[model samples]
Target: MRLLDNIYAGERVSAADAVRLFELNLTELGAVADFRRRQAVPDERVGYIVDRIVNYSNRCVACCEFCAFHADAGMIAPYDLSFEEIIEKIGELVVGGGTQVMLQGGLHPDHPLDWYLDLLRCVKTSFPHIWLHSFSPAEIVHIAILEGMSHGEVIGRMKTAGLDSVPGASDLLVDSVRRRVSPRKCTRGQWREVMLALRDADMVSSATMTYGLDETLEERVEHLCFVRTVQDETGILQAFIPWSFSPANTRMCEVAPAGGVDYLKTVAVARIVLDNVDHIQAGWLTEGPELAQLALCMGANDMGGVLTEELVVQAAGIHTRLTAADMEDLIQNAGKIPMRRDSRYQELGHEG
Candidate 1:
């Protein structure tokens, strides 16, 4: 109760307090988290975005143990979307009234930094109105390492080329978990450095966490603290998104996946812990719409995006899709106003 009292008194919860909050029953945790959510949001409105995630290439050298989306060179024939193909995808998004495009891809071994810059320029030239919220810190780090450039230089160039914002795809922010799951990908320190670079460039981005990868709850709390610390320093993180890891069809297929209760608890705890971040996103792509709908009451204020197409989680054998209309209806049915938002959490319109 004291923890809840402190949280309600506008005091920042410590890491130990976050871990203890996870020990509370679901109802108690959700109630406190919902209280924090109302204090932060102060509105009965839930926001969703009409966006698309374009995986330009599946070929990845990271070989993360939890990933089912990446293809090794010889395991499967890799394909990179031709510039024309990517344009076609964005065109389809535009036709669906999409305002944002997230160009996510694996760490391809051969692509040069110029290749990404050119793609960003090409997308901007083709659809200047579409918000290009693309790429993760891992991809930026890969580019920087490939080109012998600093992370700041890579982000600066991408910003100039019309990259509106970056996604916080630094899957698990704990170094221990990163070593166990994604050894070849950027380390926790590198991820922080790239985020600092984004802040330096005055570019806003989101923070994400993928739990249930055999990580301890304390490690999960550590991840939240890391995000909060970065937000305290940079103030560039606009949202915090926490999703359960899907292990099917991947190397870690033997691992039992997290269930809906864990997912909801994570969402509620994230909302309570990430007090500095403005928005907390509910991930329907992995958890399905029903649980995501329940997440609205458990502290999440954003339903993420109506992903026109999502392959990463689908590759793990979880296929959940929603259209803009479905999003509006879902939010309204949840007893909240359905507001459409862009990449920066700016309300575009609403359907009450």
Candidate 2:
């Protein structure tokens, strides 16, 4: 109760307090988190984006144990989309009134840095109006390691190639958990460095957490605190997304998936811990639309995007897609105005 009192008094919650907040009953925690959400976003509007996630290549050297999407180059015939194919995908998104495109892929060992640069150049040349929110910290770090460059240098080149923003797709930001699950992926420190590089480049990005990876509650709090510290220093993180990890068709499939109660609690706790971040997104694609609607009422103010094509999560045995109209109806059903937003969280327009 004292913690709740301090939170209401405009005081920031400590890491220890965040860990303890997880112990509170779901309803009580939601009440406090919803209160904070109202303080940060007072309007009755919830935002969604019209976007697509384009996987350029599935050939990856970083064989993360938790990913069912990455193809093993030796066993599986890895596929890379040619420039024409990728452009066609973006063209379709453009025709559907999409304003953002997230181009993410695995760590392809064979491609040179120019391959990625040319891809960005080609996409920009074709669809100059689409916001290129592509690449995760792991992808950026992979490029740096392959090209013998620093993270900042690689991000600088990416920005020149018309990359609008980066996505915080680091599965979990705990080094121990990373070792257990995605050992070949970027370390927690490397992920933070890439984010700092984005800040230095004057770019914007969203932070994400994929929980229920057999990690402890304290580890989850640590992840939230890590993002909060980064935002406090750079003010670059625009949104915080906490989603349950899907374990189907992956090496970690035996791990029980997080249920609806855990999902909402994590979202609420993230909202309370990440006081500096502006937006919290409901993970509709992973948790289903109904639970995502509950999350909006709990603490979330964003419904993520109408991802026209999402492969990674689909590979994990979860499939959901939404048209722009469906997004509006879903938000309206939750009793909030659905506003169209760009990648930068800039309001486009909403129907009255």
Candidate 3:
């Protein structure tokens, strides 16, 4: 009750106290988080996006142990999608009534900066109205590595080339946990730097947590605190998405995956802790729509995108294909009005 009272009174909980939240009942956590969600976002409408995730290349240089999506360099048939091929994907998205496309890919070590810029140009040139919510902080850093430029410089150039926003991918934020899982990916400093740069460029992005990768409970709370700090400073993060780690077919496949209880607890804690971040999205792709529906009352305000198509998580053995209608039904079933939104969190329309 004190936790709920404190949260409702708008006080920040310490990291140690946050870790103790795990000891409480799952439904209690969800109830407090739902209370906070109502306090911040009183709307009974939950937002969903009609978007597709496009993987431009499976080629990767980062030796992330958790990823089964990447094709290691010089091993097997790793290839980048030709610009024309990418355009075709965009065409499908346009035809499918998709308002956004998440252009995700491995850190293609061979591609130059111009190659990415050209792709952005091509997308904007071909589809002017589609929100180009592409690339992760990791990808930006990779481009910087290839181009011998700063992360800020790469982000600025991408913005110039019509990149509307960035995704908070590869963000297991705690450096110790990150070193264990993705030592070759961007560091916490680099991730924070890129996010701040996006804020400076007026490009809002999401904050994410990919937990269950052998991280401590305190570390999880640390991640929430870190994102909240950034939000307090910039107030530009549009949402926070917490997803459980899927170990299927990965190098770390021997480990057991995070369960539904952990997923709900993380989502609820995120909603309660990330007081400055307006939105919290549950990953239906990884957690399934059933639990994702339960996550609505557990302090999630967004159902995320329908994801007409996806690949990375699919490679990790997660493939939940939900259309716009499926997403609307799921949200409605959760007792929330289903509202469609763009990548920028702009309300497009209501389903009912």
Task: Kindly list the per-residue Cα lDDT of model 1 for residues 213-246, writing each as its tens digit.
Answer: 9999999999999999999988999898899888
Query: Least lDDT summed over 10 consecutive residues: which range in candidate 3?
Result: 72-81
Measured against the true structure, the TM-scores of the candidates, in listed sequence, are 0.97, 0.97, 0.97
How does model 3 score by TM-score?
0.97
Worst 10 contiguous positions by lDDT, candidate 1: 70-79
What overall lDDT goes with each candidate model?
A: 0.89, 0.90, 0.86
Rate residue 128 of model 3 by lDDT.
Answer: 91
The better candidate by lDDT, 1 or 3, is: 1
The numbered model that scores best in lDDT is 2
Give per-residue CA lDDT, model 2, range 116-231, as digits (tens): 88999999998889999998999889889999999999999989999989988857799999989888899989988998899999999989999999999999999999989888
Write candidate 3's Cα lDDT for 120-190 as tens digits: 99999999998988889888888888889988899899889989998777467889988888988999888
- Clash count, predicted structure 3: 0
Model 2 lDDT on a 0 to 1 scale: 0.90
Which 10 successive residues of model 2 have the least lDDT summed? 69-78
